[model samples]
Target: MPAYEIDGYDNLIAGMVQPIVTQSIIINQATDAKFERGTVLARTGFTEEGMWVCTIVNSEATPAEEKVPVGVLADEEVDATTAQQRATAYVSGEFNRDALIFGGTDTIATHEAALNAAKIYTKRVVK
Candidate 1:
């Protein structure tokens, strides 16, 4: 399998909804080269921190111009600038890893679920 680069953002919106936006790069197998760009997945929301988990099901790459309709569920209306800022902050090592699980979970299921869901959006880029 080819190596993939995953990058995205998630913001808690209203109710139990958290919008997740992702872009992934799929390496080209034929030329042993990186794909030109990535593809957007969806514009849907997931349950906030519980109830369910979303893992990286899979990914594929294409041209950047090809816009894929991804979901967005933010409590506050997020503009393109804000989204870009969040993405940059994420890539710039501004987020706290431990803060993700600041409060201890009451149950193993809950903790495991949060970890699994978080792994989908966790990029190790240190800036």
Candidate 2:
């Protein structure tokens, strides 16, 4: 007889507002590197082939836009190490703060205002 195995999934979103808003964005291979579910994103304010490009939001970045949190990555782990890839992002929604990934000296306190401004709310999930 052969042995079998099973896998489990993790949910990053804690809650959502009515009519969830999402956008198809291009992950910048040179900047983003890799993407995991619930990774915060920011617009690079540039596009390639007519699609908007984005990368992980960095609080220490010099660019104003790069320091702003615009969306949350709503996909499974994406390997953008080799080439740019298209993925979906939650433009506006409620998410679990514990599950979110930050970059470059960013913390929930640092980007709280920016996240609120963008209509992306995060909740403290007790678990």
- Across 1-127, the per-residue lDDT of candidate 1 in tens digits comes to 2212334532121112223333321211222211111111222223443222111111232332212222111112112321221110110111222222211122223233333343323222332
Tens-digit per-residue lDDT, 1-127, candidate 2: 1111224534566675534588888886774478788789989865746666888899888877788888888777666888888888888878777788888878888887888789888888876
User: What is the number of backbone collisions in each predicted candidate, taken in the order shown?
Assistant: 6, 0
Can you give the TM-score per candidate against the true fold?
Answer: 0.17, 0.83
TM-score of 1: 0.17
Error of 1 at 94 (Å): 14
Q: What Cα-based lDDT does every candidate model obtain?
A: 0.22, 0.77
Best by TM-score: 2
The per-residue C-alpha lDDT of model 1 at residue 96 equals 22
Output the worst ten-in-a-row residue range by lDDT, candidate 1: 85-94
